[model samples]
Target: MTAGNVVLGLCSYTHDSAAALLVDNVLVGFAEEERLTGDKHTAAFPERAVNWLLDTAGVDPHSVGLVAYNFDGRRYLDALAATEMYAGRDTTRDRAQPRAESFRKVHDRFGSRMADLRDRFRRARVVPVLHHRAHGLYSFASSSYDAAAVLVVDSLGEVQTTTLGSGRRLAGGGCRTTIVEDIADPASLGYAYGAVTEHLGWRRGDEEGTVMALAALGDPTRFRALLREAIPITDGGFSLDPRWFPLRVLAHDYPRVSAGFIAATCPARDPSAQVEAVHADLAAALQERTEQVMVHLARRVRSVTGLRLLCLGGGVAANCVAVGKIVEAGIFDEVHVPPAAGDSGTAIGAALAASLDNTRHLATGVTGRCYLGPAYPRLVLAENPRPGLTAHRPAAPAKHVAMKLAEGHTVGVFSGNLEAGPRALGNRSILASPLLPDVVERLNDTVKFREPFRPFAPVVLASAMADYFTLPQPAPYMSIASGVTDLTRERIPAIVHVNGTARVQTVTADANPFLTEVLTEFAALTGHPVLINTSLNVKGKPICGTPDMALDCLTESGLDALMLEGWWVSKC
Candidate 1:
């Protein structure tokens, strides 16, 4: 296998498909397919993402030397689809196509359906990585630890849903991951959470965050006994009770809970049905139970590896509440959860694992980076304003933004690079004063069009974060949900949830220069450094990625103004 200078990483054939490029083993660009395709958690091959990354970075397609795909199982699965298409019949029923013909079809299909992508890699060697291993690799490689325990959990990754391992940077350069334990499906803690999400009458993959928000409002004790019995903590690791859940995950099946479990608990609620106190209580129970399992897993990893630091990745790791619980448990001195901790981030993992002869595994301790996607310079944005809008160049952009927020006007910000993850750090965020009494209601009803129960996050100044929240560590990525102080609840009530906790994203001058200035100015004006920061997108849509997309959002949504690079825009 040739480890070449330019390695392109891809995560596809699953939701949140993305493309990441590594020039000389250095991560140059990363973007999700959803961002450009405007489909939330889209599973389509990231054609637009790849094109955007390549074009924005000015990398020639022919120059790419290696293609690293995150999912290894796709090789076997793609062949089945090819065989069916080759014979023009269901391969499972016919069983007539030969192995050679099937492989030939795979080869031909790559040259046709993926013609452009295949031709772009005419001189490149393609490699596949195991899904769980990639998740483990990303969290470890991106962390600042010399060596740390790694925990990766999701609904399912190829086969295993959870993996425990240790990672350490090599003395010479690149990093290495050593696997300790693997937990397969149906028994997965992540699937258990997803099952609960489905049972709560919400979309499993998309609305799990909503359920998490609902957990903050409910009584966990109501279903505490049932959940403890369903997912009891084991000596090695926790396992889901088969009596409560289906043995396997059936595609397109809602509420994969067993009949016995349904009879014991409650019937599955419809998506359109109103969420009641019982549903919230069940959500609270599921979240609490899930946190116990995570803490147990972390303790096991610590005992096995004797490492003080932990790096977490995958879908379950997206649960900031569980992350906060693990942090409070003190299993690790520091827990590193990247801005993009889910499957889309596996693209970065795949590239980091592959090394080139010339580059010494490009230094990718991107602990300070969230703005790492497509960026439009001031020059790129057309000075000519769009129809029905007026544009102006402010003397002090940050102060102007602060002034608008102080007046209770919600401002959409489109500046610098697009954030690589789900959270809108600042560059692509809708900012409002968290001090406003009805800010949440206004944003939910007019702009976001989201569920009222789902609370917005606060982008707080890093130096001021400790003054308000009981966070164990700095959360620049909004990856941990920590309890809010009384001062916070009194001052910035809009961002605080019923649980007296807030998902906070701390910002510093080094992390985001513009946002740092904006926060400083806002604090000076309102005597509060916090702002309600939500992703710059309408509900059910991906975050805005380009100037045109940002403009489209400003026009379609209830944003009072937009702070684009070098220009202030408002509807006439």
Candidate 2:
């Protein structure tokens, strides 16, 4: 069958399930199931997201050339068996027989699901791409560099937990990727990191960022020896000592491994209370060790590939702190981490891999911004105004919002399409003046209801990024953290973390014009072109998706006003 211009991508039955529509190899629509369903890190099938993308793109599902799924269940079974054997689990004929039969049934069920998708789509063929390969493809394809060493490190992807590869743009306009190494299951840095997160009394995958934040408050030297024993950095790869963390029976059972590690290393304590100094030190050590291993990996990749550009994906790539360390090391001239570096981005990678030959016309370089979700009409806000709020359609919404932010009002800005990944990136974001230190406490206590240690990101005008943070280039997506300059630390205390760093998102006029305008106006008012930006949602909820969700966030949270598309609504 000839590959057509349209392809649909789906990622489900794993965390951060999402769907994407690629028309003629150009991504037209994308969204996570969590946003549409109001479920955080949903693993359920993204049927609603798929339907929404199809409707938004005005493409008939039946006409899609291919439906790419970011999983291979067969590989999963192989990895599970390997993990059991590595852990010294009884895998003799007597024990392996029933497991083999059960695996066959599960594999057959996965095959049937793919067949069902094919039947439902009628003319479309369903293709399954290996999870880490999908992540590598997305990282390489979405990057601006023509060739780069790709690294994918996640908790688990099929049988492999980490992949090192290379991607290059073909002279013929397509892209090719080759895997150089694969770190199989049970020796996963991602899982190790998740285990530390669990040990710190945070949800593994969901709260790893919180652990990263808390790391800033502790001294890594305190637990350096313990962490070194847990995860040893090898020559070309890293090893998670099985003694420290046994091979997990289930991928998400990180708490078990975490409990074991904590029991072996630290003093006994209550699990539900605030983090103690030891917990912070452990977090620090884990974070430091992760950065060391990542930098070592990057250096090895560069040495092997001789490529100056590096592209990273997978759950571990979401560690802006580690990314910053990699950049500071100067192992690679440039590094690109896609906005949706996590599993949600595998949808795009699967679509790209399946539609490789069809992507000649797709825009080259970085793919610009990630505002690929649904966009609400301005009329919707006008027609449905919430109570005790006055809606005003100003001549210049950006300027009005900028003035409010200058006055220290926290504003929820919901504009254009929602972002595809975790970071808010102006759209579906809460904005405030970064100069006021109290703003962080306010946002933590009232708006986000998150831990005080969780630092906010700064959305700075791209042109002005160098003035604030010492960065080589613009971080269009909040994918990396950079040290705040001493001036910046003093000027924008709200966004600066205890370690004097900020997860910075630099916006260009071409990518986010409204946000640029708002920053431009804000600069004119406050002599700074930066704002404290956090996702526009309460704690434990997915970022706001629609106008109604934005309204609800505004009313429930401490946001002073909300900018929905072009309509501004202020609480009375």
Report, for every candidate in turn, its global Cα lDDT versus the true structure.
Answer: 0.80, 0.82
Off by over 4 Å in 1: 1-3, 74-120, 253-255, 356-367, 379-387
Residues 1-572, candidate 2: write the lDDT tens digits: 14487788888775799998887666877899898778899988898899898887777776788888888777757844542454355323233344345445656778877877787788887888888889998888778878999989898886688888899887767678889987875579998888777766788789899989999999999889878988987776887776576545552323345445666557443456867888888888989999999888888888878888999999999999899999999888889999899999999888887777445443232265588888886455543387778887889899999999988899999988889799999889999998775888899999998888888899999888888999786798899889888779667777888887889999998889999999999999999999998999998899988777788888898889998888889887
Residues 1-572 of candidate 1 have per-residue lDDT tens digits of: 23366778888766799988877556788898888777889878888988887786677777777777776654433334444443453312232255334444444553443444466588777766778877888788777788999999887775577888898877767666888988765468878888888888888887789999999889999999999988988887887775676554234533368777778667888988888998999999999999889999999999988999999999898898899999989888999998789989998877776542235553463545667788777444444478878888889999999999999899999989888778899999999999887899999989998788889999999999888899878898888988988898777778888877788999989989999999999999999899999999998788998788888899888899899886899888
Candidate with the greatest lDDT versus the true structure: 2
Give the residue spans of candidate 2 off by over 4 A.
1-3, 80-109, 251-255, 258-260, 267-272, 357-366, 382-384
Model 2 global lDDT (CA atoms, 0 to 1): 0.82
CA RMSD for every model?
5.7, 2.9
User: How many backbone clashes can be found in candidate 2?
Assistant: 0
Indicate the TM-score of model 2: 0.93
Query: What C-alpha lDDT, on a 0 to 100 scale, does residue 231 get in candidate 2?
Result: 90
TM-score of candidate 1 on Cα atoms, chains taken together: 0.90
